[model samples]
Target: MYRLVLLVLLALPLAGCFAPRAEDTARNWRPMGANGLALGRLVALSPGVTRATWEAFAGIKGQTVVRLAAEYDPVRAAAGCPPPEAGMVRAARSFLIVDLAVTPQKSVDFIAAKAQAYSADGYFEEYDLDIGVIAALAARARPMPCADLALPGYLR
Candidate 1:
């Protein structure tokens, strides 16, 4: 029984290696809860402050990290994501939706901690996401003007 449990534990990472790729469009991506992806491996598909932060945090000394980013689009959220948190709707339109994503290296605890930090900063709401979904969102995301909503050194 101990051996079986050990085997299962060892195979967990390999399981992630086989998960389906998230389609490259918000319209094609599954809804948040329905996205059949583990909470680990958050997505960041474009270069920006958030992406840089995530890379510094999770990219271990020799690990090949894939960094990405997506600008938040309220118009696509209704179709691609779950309903926004209470203040998110107004904030999304007014403030830059600076959601952050980490690749599949850090533990869930690490992400939870990062989320707490991001939330306490009072900038944008954080969401658990897979790299594929983020890629899809990135593909569909248009360059919306965020100069008025952006905070210095935050997502851009």
Candidate 2:
């Protein structure tokens, strides 16, 4: 039971990351590490992909996730980021698979919000290089406070 509760707590933040607004599609400019705080990175789509695949890839970091988000790293993107020397790659792949399976298909706004969140800190700018591929799964259909999801009367 403790593990289950812990898992849910961990999931809440990830869950919050998937909220969306209606006008999100119109605003395409992605936010990247604004105001400073090395956290995440985003690689936008030259050709956008499906929601399922996109959700599977968002907010990538930490010991277990096993993925990297390098919006600034050109060489790494081209390299296809070969797995590390020992077992890190396997561990990352396993965690990613689990994340993909668990996250549901969310709105485009959710995806955009995630992009913004990366910018909220310094996540996007931190990554050294990530260009060319748009992303492996660099977005989450996340919600924003300024977006439609929040009610003006209650929120403000």
Please report the candidate that would top TM-score against the real structure: 1
Q: lDDT score of model 1? A: 0.33
Report the Cα lDDT for residue 34, model 2. 37
Worst 10-residue stretch by lDDT in candidate 2?
90-99
Clashing pairs in 1: 44-68, 44-69, 45-68, 45-69, 46-68, 46-69
The clash numbers for all candidates, in the given order, read 6, 20
- Candidate 2 per-residue lDDT over residues 1-156, each given as its tens digit: 999999988897786654542122212223332342211223233112112222223342311111222122222222333433332121100111111111223212122212211222222211111221223333332111112111112211
TM-scores, all candidates, are 0.26, 0.18
Q: Name model 1 segments beyond 4 Å from true.
A: 1-58, 79-122, 131-156
lDDT of 1 by residue, 71-150 (tens): 33333323333444433332342212222222344212121111111222466544343334333334443222222222
Candidate 2 lDDT: 0.25
Displacement of residue 50 (Cα, Å) in model 2 is: 5.4
Top-lDDT candidate index = 1
What is the overall TM-score of model 1 with all chains considered together? 0.26
